[model samples]
Target: MPNTDREVHLRKAVLWLQKKDPTTKKIIQTIGPCTHKMIGNPYYVLIRSVISQQLSVQAARTMENRVKEYYGNGKQFPKPDVLVKLTKPQMRKAGLSFAKIEAVKLISKAYLDGSISDRKLSKLNDQEVLDLLCSIKGVGPWTAEMVLMFSLDRWDHFSYNDLILRKSIENNYGIPMNSKKEILEFTSGYSPYRTIFSWYLWRASVGIENL
Candidate 1:
């Protein structure tokens, strides 16, 4: 959540979106209010997002838990040193694919070399953060965008290429097969709260809580 005045603006954002797009309005009505609790620690957020790629929610959580249990003493995720020390076979034993293991190792190497630090990363703007993180071999725009919203608590960033987000938009608004440029322009009015819009679309994607 934002500060008091920001909350006021967010409520107003809700109303403005309701008036601008019917699909958004219906979703706002049913979903009621944003309950997004920000996750912590940039490093952990990146690791978890990588682990979650192409997996169901439950399966992802299970794999994440396994990682935490083995390397993190069953309390929290391991630190960068622990991640760097774990061999590929050990990471695979934790249920990560070979590719994801490599990804995690690259991330750990970046951390150790001071290429990306929580302190340094926290100060960078969204675009800079995206570029720097994507410089790593395995990280990409989607993962960087997830870090922006989940870890850094940036409100405006959105992942245009996420399949589920695209599917949700199509299902709710009947706007599939549009180019990324058009989709982004269509969402421009959402502005700083695009992440909130994404949360609603994610809910809609599952068909369980959708209107």
Candidate 2:
């Protein structure tokens, strides 16, 4: 129940994962133990996902800082109600597209109104969480998958639609770009460790120091 205990428990999941897949074992031995912890609110994670859509990492962070500064007085991300109050034009001023502004509004309203509570969402499995989040306006499968892995700490998720993940697989495994079935089958061996594999693949895509 304590935060430290929870942190330990989550890291233990990574150890279990390392044992489950050899590729993961090799990756982690080089990268060191995965230290990712589930922190922050789900609503904020989803909002960031929406804002970062189709943008480079540098550009996305710039836009994200603008939104945070404008709504949160340069202190933190805006609270849900405050985020909802920011009108479309105001959001656009912060670099959000019209569609993304609407998405943020919908997600903020859901957060404010308790439709997307952390407690409720935390209880759902990855697939259920994916389905619920994807029901929102700007949340595609990739966005929902990101939320599941990074926000909720669901370790089994692998985004079939994530281009970076696909590229990583193709380059590392020599799987063809179009071979979705082969990719899925290969990754399935990772089982509960797929997200851990995904984290490594993401690292590999960016040129990990080891390889």
Candidate 3:
């Protein structure tokens, strides 16, 4: 289970990051809100992560809509039982790649078999969650990191493997970042709120928007 006062931890993390490094201060200043819409449900989080993989926001949104339409009402996310029953052709018709369809099936199977559940996941640590998530086909470290940040609300995740983040870090630090390990090391100073730092990096990589 998460610490009782997760928000307190988040606030502490933000303060710690601001004090630890000047670059992080700039990042926080640039990206006004680190906390956005929370993905509280595991099923929705998994679905959104899958839909967004390797796709632009517009494309992902389109695909997500199509999937939701097929599932009906679009309010309730498709359950694992319903998703597992979807044939690859049907999923492909909904704009998902065959690989993604297969991956979704694997995840659904895991869920139905009691290997992955909401309560079970909440009991695991961050690393444990990552490990369990990666056991599913087509789910990688980056995807697992997304689940941790958006779904589980883990405050400290930094996806150094993200290209936009790498670019932002390089620009901020005035140093070329060619290795994920190096990026991880550089982000260590922003402990407990590395995800917030990462959100800032992503925003900075794009453009500043009105808060």
Candidate 4:
């Protein structure tokens, strides 16, 4: 459950979205107010996003659990120092691919070197945060966007790099999102509240076939 503050914010965001886009309004009416919680630590969420790339949800969860179990008794996420020490063989044992292991290492290194500072990130705007995260070797715009939306709980974030979102917009809005410009133009109406829009779209995508 969202806290009192988040609940109020969700209400406002939903109302704003309902007025901005008819399709998303229908989704909000069907799903009710957004109840999604942002619970993960910033670095942990980034690492999990890396693990999740190109994998099914179940597979990603399995791999993430394996890493946790190997390093932190399956419950706690490893600290940056511990995670940065992961060897190729150890990561392989935890079901991480070579590329993902590198990404994880680079993310861990950023944390250890103070390149990724939680306090500093908390002060940044959405674009600033994206710029900082995307500066790392393995972090892309998509990963940075996840950090903004999932970890920082930035309500305005909309990632053109997220295929699921593009498809959801296409299916729900009946608009072709073949290009970034089209997606941006369509989503621009929900600015400063696209996170709410995204949460509802994720819900709508669950049972929608052909997505």
Question: Local distance difference test, per candidate?
Answer: 0.82, 0.79, 0.77, 0.81
Instruction: Give the lDDT of residue 122 in candidate 1.
Output: 89
Evaluate model 3: give its TM-score. Answer: 0.88
Identify the superior model by lDDT, candidate 3 or candidate 4.
4
* Predicted structure with the largest TM-score when compared to the true one: 4
Candidate closer to the true structure by TM-score (higher is better), 3 or 4? 4
Tell me the spans in candidate 1 whose CA falls farther than 4 Å from its real position: 1-6, 207-211
lDDT of 4 by residue, 1-211 (tens): 3588788877887888888756777888987767767758788788888888877667877988988999876887798899888789988999888888898888888888888877778789988998898888778988888888888889887888777788888988877867788889878878888877777777787642211
Off by over 4 Å in 2: 1-25, 207-211
User: Per-prediction RMSD in angstroms?
Assistant: 2.5, 3.1, 2.8, 2.9
Tens digits of per-residue lDDT for model 2, 1-211: 5778867875886777678656667767776766655546687678888888888777988999998888887846788888888878888899888998988889988888788877888899877888888888888998887788878877787777877789888886788867899989988977776887787787766743221
Clashes of 4: 0
In candidate 2, position 179 carries an lDDT of 89
Which ranges of candidate 4 are over 4 A from the true structure? 207-211
Candidate 2 weakest ten by summed lDDT: 202-211
Task: Residues 2-108, candidate 3: write the lDDT tens digits.
Answer: 55466666666677777877887877776654553355577678877877788866787788888888864685558889999988888889889988888888988
Q: Report lDDT (Cα) of residue 29, candidate 4.
A: 90
Structure candidate 4, residue pairs in collision = none
Per-residue error for 47 in candidate 3, Å, reads 2.0
